[model samples]
Target: MAGTYSVNTNLIAKLAELRITEKDIHACKLPAYEQSGNLVQAEDDMFGRTQLMTPATLTSWQNLKKAAQDEGITLLLVSAFRSIDYQCELIAAKLERGQKLSDILSVNAIPGFSEHHTGRALDINTPDCEPLSEAFEETPAFTWLEANASRYEFGLSFPRDNEFGISYEPWHWACRLLD
Candidate 1:
């Protein structure tokens, strides 16, 4: 993926504040994502938080959700479009709770490196599953996504033993831009 945003001094400083070094960033296989400047309000998530995404992503998400609904599956949005600052805050909070940075980094991408910064990634859940849990893979929604999400240009970001070294997140999907 091409990054439209550069790692400026501010982002570098933020990463440093969170104890992330240039070596650490380079070591991660995930690419840095630029925050989308043309995001539109997609919808309210399960927790009533306003979610935003690129217009193309929003259209694909709606179409994907409708297709799933037509097949008696329900996909609920848990998260979308997290900012670099928000990612930093999440990591800082975990650190404050005494979690090891290495442990936290496995799950949460370091600041600007998160796919969420691109406004194309989503965390989805179904009514029957716990939000953000690996148990989501057991749901019919997951099976349906595995079978059909590609038709709508969405794909699971991290499956078992993904190249990025991130944990397997069954609920995290990203809408890929067509070339």
Candidate 2:
């Protein structure tokens, strides 16, 4: 046989076009009702933890939850749908916690680039546990996700090989095109 041929660039180009667009993305902002009716009441959950999400995201979470339950794995929603100000506060707190500004920028997405800004993204936890870690990712929660998340229209937003600007976040998951 002659030399093997590589994949065609034209085919790759066609495939790329099918990918989701920025416009289809939705950022976590003040909820509609909160924006117009209860600005003062728009508060972050105690200690900056919250699990609010857009309808699309909630649906995805429901699916994920159901699948996890079917397999006897319990996954808890730790944080979701953060507002711009809430993000700012989080950044400031991290800064106060002795993290260098540059270091913060490296792993954490700037306000705009934050998938947390998109109501579709979530940071999950186990019962009474804190922020997620590799230990958790290798546990029942992550295993359950690996087995069923795609079926529920959720995907690991940042993996080791992610092209996204952010670092790999084992706990973060994004819902199908936040459109």
Candidate 3:
């Protein structure tokens, strides 16, 4: 199945051309967020918000979801693979509503810097939790993830006060499938 997933040539070229490091990848700068690739929606046998992930990412996520379910924790996907274009449109829509880009950037990641562009980040919530909010941390699903997500190679991509300066999002999780 891994063969079905090819590396994002554009992202590699962008990274190579820009010489971005790990720290740069997390930066809010425009150069850091430039990426493009093919995507596939994965909803078969899954629930909640439909997700788009690299085929391999979807496989790993399925494994992780099963683990959560075995523990009686049903995680709901709130968001997933988002194209840089879509993200930009979202920001544009916000701007149209009179929201400042700086304020939007504080909450929503600036395009390419968003993990959702990589098709590996997941915004998970429980039936009782609020999606994309810190209140999710109080849910049993969050507790289960905190204790066991890493076992599936999934980890919280950002925590409170993370260097990226984005707001705390307890529902966000990422699969570092590449490394």
- What TM-score number comes out for model 1? 0.91
Q: Which ten residues in a row have the lowest lDDT in candidate 1?
A: 1-10
Q: Candidate 3, residues 46-101: lDDT per residue as tens digits?
A: 25556687776777778888988998989877777888667767766887888865
Q: Each candidate: what lDDT?
A: 0.90, 0.58, 0.69
Q: What is the Å distance of residue 79 in model 1 from its true position?
A: 0.5
Clashing pairs in 1: none
C-alpha RMSD between model 1 and the true structure: 2.3
Each candidate: how many clashes?
0, 1, 1
Error of 2 at 133 (Å): 1.1
TM-score for every candidate vs. truth?
A: 0.91, 0.65, 0.76
lDDT of 1 at 6: 59
Report clash pairs, candidate 3.
33-112
After best superposition, candidate 3 residue 80: deviation in angstroms?
A: 0.7
The lDDT ranking, best first, is 1, 3, 2
- Per-residue lDDT tens digits for candidate 2, residues 2-76, read 111222444234323433122212221212111111112112443564356777677677777877887788877
The worst-scoring run of ten residues by lDDT in candidate 3 lies at 1-10
Count steric clashes of candidate 1.
0
